[model samples]
Target: MGTLVTGYVVLTAYLVEPDGPWDQQAVTNSKVAGAIGLVFSALMALLTMAFVRAGWLRKWWHAIPAALAITALLRLTLLAAEL
Candidate 1:
């Protein structure tokens, strides 16, 4: 889920850049955002797995909302920036 969110955000940011602004800062921002998301997702996934193994969070459903929200926000933010 986190991987999906990070990929969506990174891909959208890349696609939009070619269609519009070609600024270095925009590229840097995208890279930074993607990197941060990747790191966060890695951490969260690890923690979630650990929790599940410990008999705490037993379902993947717990992470669904956050993943969906991140994906939606990534798309919206890209559209807004393009606009």
Candidate 2:
């Protein structure tokens, strides 16, 4: 769930301005959105970790969502830098 949400947020940031209207302001807006998405992804990952520690998520594979969220956040960071 967290991975899906992070993917959607990152995709939205990527698709913000697909055309030639990518001015400085547009880039700044996209960066801001990406930053927010990164923060959200981080929080979701942390929450997933907490759940796992609390025994709510018993399986070892339950950590995969947090790992995927972190990966998405890393990619989003690179994308924001490129923007």
Candidate 3:
């Protein structure tokens, strides 16, 4: 999941700038968005693994929905920017 999200961000960023930096502003925005997605996904994966190992399955299960919501929100934000 983390990899998929990050890959999408990277791919989008590259596509958004196929030939060098189209504009500093666009590149900056893409980098920021990619960083946010990368950080959130990495943190969620780490927390999930830790929760599972610590026998917090119930809580982790509850958190999954929120994590997914954020993921969707992020995707929407990225797509919206492209448009």
User: Lowest lDDT 10-mer window, candidate 1?
Assistant: 74-83
lDDT of 2 at 23: 61
lDDT of 1 at 8: 64
Q: In candidate 2, which residue ranges exceed 4 Å CA deviation? A: 1-4, 58-77, 80-83
Q: Candidates' lDDT values, in order? A: 0.56, 0.63, 0.56
* Alpha carbon RMSD to native, model 1: 7.3
Q: Write the per-residue lDDT of candidate 1 for residues 5-68, one digit (tens) a residue.
A: 6556556545544335556665556556555654555566676777778888777744743574
Ranking by TM-score: 2, 1, 3
Count clashes in each candidate, considering only residues at least 3 apart in sequence or on different chains: 0, 0, 0
Candidate 3 overall Cα lDDT vs. reference? 0.56
- The lowest-lDDT stretch of 10 consecutive residues in candidate 3 is 13-22
- To one decimal, what is the Cα RMSD in angstroms of model 3 from the true structure? 8.4
Candidate that scores best on TM-score: 2
